[model samples]
Target chain A: MHGYTANKDDILKRLRRIEGQVRGLQRLVDEDTYCIDVLTQVSATTKALQSFGLTMLEDHLYSCVADAIAEGGDGARDKVQEASQAIARMVRT
Target chain B: MHGYTANKDDILKRLRRIEGQVRGLQRLVDEDTYCIDVLTQVSATTKALQSFGLTMLEDHLYSCVADAIAEGGDGARDKVQEASQAIARMVRT
Candidate 1:
């Protein structure tokens, strides 16, 4: 099981909603919606995607990262480093 | 015609690609992919959405906003303020 295994359905639901948001964006463009309106929708979609990422990060930290650290080994250090890099990518994006 | 009218096709294409990215994320989660790997994909998808928003904002500034400012009246001020608010929403998200 992965770090998010316990809440797999919830995660999938969030992703599905985000997928719908992307589809909505296409529909807006298809209808020649105003630029500012379309941009506003885009911002909303981006925020949803970012929120999903944050939830996943939190789950990972609470489960896999915590487990590794509790065991006290090189794996724990590596996991923390890897997680930090992932956070950096999210922030930069 | 809106600011993005000239490149409507391109915008739609980008949104389609982003939709695919979101679907891929679902597949990864379905397969119980590692948390870090999933988070990385999430970041990539978020960046793509943000980039799409920026492109729309640029087009708006070039066309609609520019036209208002050239007219030089209350409309110009209103357009600038509206655009500024849109930018704030994007950044805050």
Candidate 2:
């Protein structure tokens, strides 16, 4: 089992906000809002999404990765390796 | 000012462990260690670092971005915009 479990409701709530922000940006584009204004809203939405991603990743590390490392088994070893490669991919982008 | 600020020491501590893990992988490669074992370590390190990135990103959202959105000013707006672009760029990769 993946050790990290996200509260579905909270995830939805954050995501909903981001969605709204994105829609607002779309509206701004439709209405010909100032470039700076649209960009600002875009920034807010992106940061929010990134924040959500961060929380999930953090939980995975503390709950899953750390636990796997402590247990010291083949399964644990495999999980740790999987996590490392996944992160390297994340950073490389 | 960027609303999110990192605890430098903690970041360094996490990074140091990652550094050690990477070095281990290097050794494994040179010595022609088991591929599976090396890949496993790589996965763990990647996840750990990704977790760190997530924490920083999350903090930036709750601490800085949220505050900026609430305040409602030119500066706040600009910051929000900056965050959005950064995040979008992040997702694209």
Candidate 3:
């Protein structure tokens, strides 16, 4: 079972809301919204998205990576290695 | 200069502080601190770390990956492809 299983719907819903927030911010630009206000909202939206992203990453590592580590086969080894690179990308970024 | 150039140190410092915050949270647990308070602080720290990670990712896409894409070579193609996987990991997380 995936760790993301429990809150998958909730996370997707939140991301959709954020996507709408971003589109609204873009429209604000088209309509010349106040720079500070738009920027403020952008910052908030960015933080929200990042929070969401982190939750998914944490779950992936805890569940998928740990499972791969425990399984110990050719496929499992590949999976674990790929997960490492994924993690390096996440934190290196 | 790198994409992480301008704020590299600052970001690292923030991460270090967050690490400290995490340790503090552990201590809170050890000391039997209020569950809600510890959880709240943990959430904040996680969000902060994620936000920082996003900044670095954005910069990498804008500068490093873009540069690799703009150039032409086996190395450049490999770099861009690797970056794609990295971004996929970030969002697919």
Candidate 4:
């Protein structure tokens, strides 16, 4: 199983809260809120997603990647590669 | 500036490493690595992205969201909504 299984509930809860926040944003846009105000909200949302992604990465490194490294051989290499790709994508965003 | 600006360089550096990892994955696939092995790499990549997202979220909450809330009124509400949407999108992924 994936390492995230350990904290899946907590993660999901956080996601749900974030979903609500998005809905609120839509409302603000609908109401014709100020441009800077909307942009600020957008900035907040982007940060939140990035933060969530980082937390997950830490868990993966500590749990999944660590396990792979302990196992050694191709497993270790693959895990490292996987992690690197994940990081690259995050940065691009 | 976004809260992540402080750590943008670090984040980008990490991302560059991840990008290399992804390239490795493509190579693995090209070499016909085992199916389970590839799957494992995929899983790792996903987790890493999620983790990255979470990190950004934390920064947003601490900096941008906090600032908006401190300012009060519509700003606070808008920030909250934006955060919620970001979380929701992350979870959906």
Mind giving the per-residue lDDT tens digits that candidate 4 earns over A1-93?
555556666755654554455555455545545434544554555555566667767777888899999989999999888888777766655
lDDT of 2 by residue, A1-93 (tens): 332223545544554565455456456545545434543554455455445555655666776677777988887888777767655644553
lDDT string for model 2 (B1-93, tens) is 332223545544654665565555455445544333444554455455445545556666776677777888886888677767755644542
Model 2: fraction of native contacts = 0.00
Candidate rank order under TM-score: 1, 4, 2, 3
Residue A76 of model 2: what lDDT? 86
What is candidate 3's lDDT per residue for A15-69, written digit by digit as tens? 8999999998989899998899999988888778766766675566445644554
Predicted candidate 1 versus true structure: per-residue lDDT over B1-93, tens digit per residue: 988988989989999999999999999999999999999999889889988999899999999999999999899999999999999998897
Per-residue error (Å), model 1, residue A75:
1.0
Determine the TM-score of chain B of model 4.
0.94
For model 3, how many clashes? 0
Scored by lDDT, model 1 comes in at 0.93
Q: What docking grade does candidate 4 earn?
A: incorrect
- Report lDDT (Cα) of residue A38, candidate 3: 96
Stretches of model 2 off by over 4 angstroms after superposition: A1-6, B1-93
Ten-residue segment with the worst summed lDDT in candidate 2 chain A? A1-10
TM-score of predicted structure 1: 0.98
Docking class of 1: high
By TM-score, the better pick of 3 and 4 is 4
